[model samples]
Every structure is written in C-alpha cells, then in structure tokens.
Target: MAGLITILIDGITYASWLFIVALGLTLVFGVLKILNIAHGSFYALGAYAAASFVGWAASMKWAPGLSLVAMLLAAVAVAALVAPLTERGLLRFFYGRDEVLLVLVTYAMFLIMEDVTKLVWGANPYYVSEPYSLFGNVDVGKQSYVGYDFALVGLAAVVGSAVWWGLNRTRIGKIVTVVIHSSEIAASMGINVSRVYMGAFAVGIFLAAIGGAFTAPMISVQPGVSVGVIIVSFAVVIIGGLGSIEGAAVGALIVGLARSIAVHTAPVAELFSIYIVMAIVLMFRPEGLFQRIQARKI
Candidate 1:
C-alpha cells in the first residue's frame, strides 16, 4: 500500500510540470496551426533565465521565498522578449506556407537556439537548487515527499483552470476561438488575426518558459535539457490530441504514470515505457484519445 501511494504521488508530481509545458504546445498548435518545434528551446531559455534570476536574487540577499518570484519573472521575460522576435520577425513571413515548410523553419530555429543558448550561457551546467527546499518536506504516511512537488501540483491546477476559464469565458478568448476555426473568416470580420496570433504565441511561450522555470531547481539547467522535454512533450500532445487542453492533461497523466511505474518496477524499460504507451494509443486512436475526426472541408 505504501509503495502504491509512492508511485501515485510520483506520477502526479511528474505529470504536473509536463502538463504545464504540453498545454502551451497544444495552444500554439490549436491557434497558430504550427507544431512549433522550437517550443522546447523557449523552455530551455526559461531555465537558464531562472538560474540567472534566482542567482541574482540570492546575491541581493533577498528572502529565499522570493526566488519563486524570480523564477516567474524569468518566464515572463523570456515570453515578452522572444515571442515578438520569433513570431513577427521570422515566423510571420512563413504564414500560409506549406505546413512541412513551417515545420522545417521551426526545426531550423530550434537548432539555432541550441547554439544561441550555448553562446550566452556557455556549455557549463547551471543549478538553481535553492528553490527546491523552499517548501521543506511533507510526510505522506510512511513515506516522505518534497513539499515543492505538491506545490507544483497545485500550480498546475491553477494554470489549467485559468487557461480554461480565459478561453471559454472571455471575449478575447471567443475571438481567438473563432480565429482558430477560420482565421480568414475572423479577419474578414475585422478581428485582427495577426494580433491574435501573436498573443496566442506569447501565451504558449509563457507556458513553456514557466514550466522550465519551476523545473530548474528539480534538474540540472544545462544544454540538451530541451531535447528530452521536447520528445516527451510531443508524445503528450500527440496522445492527448494536438491543440486540446483536456487532452494535454490526460496525456500527461498517462505518460507520467507509465514512466513512474517503469522506473519503480523495471528500470530497464524506463526509456521505452513512454513510447510503448504512445504507440499503443496511436494504434487504437490515431486522432488521439480526445480529438474528434473532422470531415475534410472542400
């Protein structure tokens, strides 16, 4: 029973951060119709930025609790600075181009950002371990867990609820939804689709960055961190159905539990467990567990 509880807690904790990242990926795909191979790069930037920001905060002798604020600011800064440059300066030009072309473009951007991160932060790993103990520890029955992990679970819940409420209950969200359905029609209605596109992209990048920010303390902030995240995030969105908020959530839980189980039971299968589950899901539901099959428009 204790072992089962540990697995469940570990799975939920892992799913929390993943859901945050995958939510952004799905949002970008839903609104902009771009798969955004560079999304993981933004996540890396967030971690690097968080490491810098939190370090600065510590140097200033700020309360350790405020490191959380620094991490959040890091995410906001990345979104504010990078989103415009990527969306307007580069991706906008490729609008209406072939989807394959867009994918290649984003892949190129990913490669470029990989080099850029090394150039700025260098190849050395950065650590933000200070924030990891902010929440101290929580005892769960016979097992003990980091309080920070439970905090992440709460944060994920808040993020998901906020995004859902914004999209379903707000005027701008309705406009964005219309644009998602038919950007041309929305533009004809004087909705300013370009601005909507930029807004959605910024929000998506913010989600990715925030995921990285919080996760910085949990792992080494270094080059190649984005690679693993990108692979798993893609798996999540694919399993949940691209562009689906609910799908992202469910997919993350499934992946997280699968990985946790593998790690606890069969360490050798840890790497393949996620992919195996993804393959099985794809076999049974190619459109994903949540995505409906839409009739092709003439």
Candidate 2:
C-alpha cells in the first residue's frame, strides 16, 4: 500500500512539469500549425535565466520565498525577448511553406540555439537548489515528500484551468480559435491573424520556459538538458494528440505513470518504457488518443 502511494505521488509530480511543457508545444501547433523543434531551446533558456535570476536575488539578500517570483520573471523575460525575434524575424517568412521545410528550419534553429546557449552559459552546470526547500517537506503516510512537488501539481492545475478558460470564454480566444480553424477567413474578417500567431507563439514559449524555470531546482541545469526534454515533450504531445490541450494533460499523465512504474519495478527498462507505451498507443491510434481522423481533401 505504501509503495503504491509512493508511485502515485511520484507519477503525479513528474506529470505536473511535463504537462506544463507539453501544453505549450500543443498550443503552438494548434494555433500556428507549426511543430516547433526549437521549443526545447526556449526551455533551456528559461532554466539558465532562472539560475541567474535566483542567484541575483540571493546576492541581493531578498527573501528566500521571492526566488519563486524570480523564476517566474525569468520565464516572462525569455518569452518577451525571444518570441518576437523568432516568430516575426524568422518564422513569419516561412509561413505557407512545406511542412517538411518548416520542420527543417526549426531544427536548424534548434541547433543554433544550442550553440548559443553554450556560448552564453558555457560548459559548466548550474544548480538552483535554493528554491527546492522553500516549501519544506510533507509527510505522506510512511513516506515524506518534498512540498515543492505538491506545489507544482497545484501550479499545473492552475495553468491548465487558466488556459482552458481563456480559450473557451474570452473574446480574443474566440478570435484565435477562428484563426486556428481558418486563418485566411479570419483575416478576411478583419482579424489580425499575424498578431494572433505571435501571441500564441509567445504563450507557448512562455509555458516551456516556465516549466524549465520551475524544474531547475530539481536537476542540474546544464547543456544537453534540452535534448531529453524535447524528446519526451514530443512523446507527450504525440500520445495525447498534437494541438489538443486536454491531450497534452492526459498524455503527460500516461507517460509519467509509465516511467514511474518502470523506475520502481524494472530499472533497466526505464529508458524504453516511455517509448514502448508510445508505440503501443500509436498502433491503435495513429492520429493520437485525442485527435480525430480528418477526411482527406483531394
């Protein structure tokens, strides 16, 4: 019973951060129709930014709890500064091009960003462990867990609810939805489709950055971190159905649980467990669990 409880907690905690990252990836795909291969680079930027921000905060002798605010600010800064340059300066030119070409373009951007990160942060690893203990510890039956983990679960719920409400209940969200369905029609209707795309891309990058910022304390912030993150994030979005917010959530949960189970039971299978589940899901639903089959247009 204790072991089961531990697994559940571990799975939920892992799923929380993953859902945040995957949500951004799906949102970008849904609105912009661009599968951004550079999304993970933005995440790495956030982590590196967070390390700097939190370090600065500590040097200033700010309250320890404010490190959270510093982390949040790091994400916002990355989105605000980087999103426009990427979307308007580069991506906008490639609009309406072949999807394969877009993929290649983003892949090139990913490689460029990877090199840029190394140049800026160098080869050394950065650790932001100060924020990890802010919430202290919570005892769950026979096991004690970090309170920060529960906080992430709560944060994920809030982020998900906020995004859902914004999209379903707001005027701008309605306009964005129309753009998603048919950008040409939306533009004909006088909506600023370009602005909508920019906004969606910014929000998506923000989600990825925030995920990395908050997760920095949990692991070493270093080069090559983005590779694993992008891979797993792609798995989550693919399993949940690309562009579906709910799919990202469900997919994260499935991947989290599968990994947790593998880690606890057969440690040797930890790496393959996620891919195995993804392959099985793809076998039954090539379009993903949440995506519906669309009729082919000649």
Candidate 3:
C-alpha cells in the first residue's frame, strides 16, 4: 500500500507539471483559435530563463527559496515584453485566417525562437538546484522524494482556482472569456477585442514561462526540453477539454496518475497511456468531460 501511495504522489506531481504547462496553451487556443506552435517556444524559453536566473542567484549566494520569486519575475518579464510584440508585430497578420496557415506561421515563429535560444544560452543543459534544496525531501513511506514536488501540486491547484475565478469574477477575465466563446460578439459590443487578445496571449505566455521556471530547478533545462512536453501537454489539454481551465487540471491528474501506474507496472505503456484516453474521450464526448450548461434566454 505504501508503494501504491508513493506512485500516486509521483503521478500527481507529474500531473501538476503537465497542468502548469498546458493551462496556458489551452487558454490561448480557446481565445485565439490559432493552435500556436510558438506556445512551446515560450515553455522552452521559460525553462531556460528560469535556469539562468536561478543559477545566477545561487552563484551569488542568495537564498535558494528566493529563486522562486526570481523564476516568476523572469517569466513575467518575458511575457510582458514578448506577448504584445508577438501579437501585434507578427500574429496579427494571420488573424481570422485558415487554421493550417496559422499553424505554419506559428511553427515558423517557434523555429526562429528555438534558434534564438541556442544563440543566447548555447546548447547545453542547465539545472537549478535551489528549489530542490529549499523544500528538501520527505519520506513518503519508504521512498524519499522532493517536497517541492508536493508543493507544486498545491501551487497548481491554487493557480487553477485563481484562473477559474479570474474568468468568472474579474472584468478583464470576463472580456477574455467572452473573446474565447465568441470574438465576433465581443467585438460587436465594442469590447476592443484586439487588446483583450493581446492580454490573453501575454497571460498565456506568462503561465508557460512560470511552468518552465518552476520546473527548471527540478529538471534539466535544455534547448529541446520544451519539445518534450508539447505533445503530451496537447493530449492533456484535449483530454481535459479544450479551453477548459478546470479540465486542464483534471486532465493533468489523470495523465499523471496513469503514467505513474504505467511507470511501475508496464513501462512500455507509460508513453501511450495519455493517447489511449484521448482517443476514448474524443471518440465519445467531443465537447469533453465537463460540458458548460446554459439556461434558455426567455
């Protein structure tokens, strides 16, 4: 039983990581309908940037706990600057176009950004140990693991709740939510959807950055690390229902736990576990597990 509990914890932590990376992707896709390949670039950039910042802090003898703030700041800084620029300068031209073209363009942008990473950071693996040391470890039954991993689960839950509240409670989040459901209606009502879209993209990018930053200290930060998660994350987003924040959280936990089981019982099944669920879900319930309910407007 202890072994099972340990595996479950491992799965949840992995799921949290998946949710953190995927939530932003779903938000952008929900709002823009672009299916951005550049989303992966942000993830990669975030990881690299976080690794760099944390490494610098450690070398300077700063507290490892402070690296968390630095990681978030780096992500926010990158998103604050890059989001508007990308939305206006490049992505704007492709608005309301074919999905395939938008995809090609974003992939081109992703390629360019990937090269930029190489140019800026070089092609080497960077790791941040501050986060690991800060939380230290815990003995879950017999196995010892990083407490930061559990902390990440809590953080992802908070982020998920905050995003849900943002969408339902805040004016800005409402506008963005409107944009997600119907941009035409939003614009017809003089909502200034263009700005909203930019802001949404910025938030999406910021989340991606934060995911990278958070994971950097726990995992190896390399140029291609973003590529590693992009596919699996898409699966999580799809399984959780597209453009659904709650769905993303739920989906991550599912995939994380499933993969954990596979890791222990059937190693070969780990890679395909998510896809199996994706196929099953898409085949039956196209809208996903949680369908929005709206009352009649009499």
Better of 1 and 3 by lDDT: 1
Candidate 3 lDDT, 1-298, residue by residue in tens = 9879978988999998789889999988888887877887898888888887877777888876788888888898789878978999999888989889999998898889989999999998887876777778888777898889988888888877887898889988878878877888998999998888888888889888888888887787887887868888888887888788888888888889888988988889988887887888888877676545446545
Candidate 1 stretches with Cα past 4 Å from truth are: none
Q: Which tens-of-lDDT digit does each residue in 1-298 have in candidate 2?
A: 9989988999999999999999999999999999999999999999999999999999999999999999999999999999999999999999989899999999999999999999999999999999999999999897999999999999999999999999999998899899998999999999999999999999999999999999999999999999999999999999999999999999999999999999999989987999999999999999999999888857
> Best-fitting candidate, measured by lDDT?
1
Work out the TM-score per prediction.
0.99, 0.99, 0.93
User: Tens-digit lDDT track for model 1 on 133-242?
Assistant: 98999998978899999999999999999999999999999999999999999999999999999999999999999999999999999999999999999999999999
Clashes of each: 0, 0, 0
Pairs of colliding residues, candidate 2? none
Order of all candidates by lDDT, from best down to worst? 1, 2, 3
Candidate 3: misplaced stretches above 4 Å? 291-298
> lDDT of each model, Cα atoms only?
0.96, 0.95, 0.84
Q: Which ten residues in a row have the lowest lDDT in candidate 1?
A: 289-298
User: What overall lDDT, based on C-alpha atoms, would model 3 receive against the true structure?
Assistant: 0.84
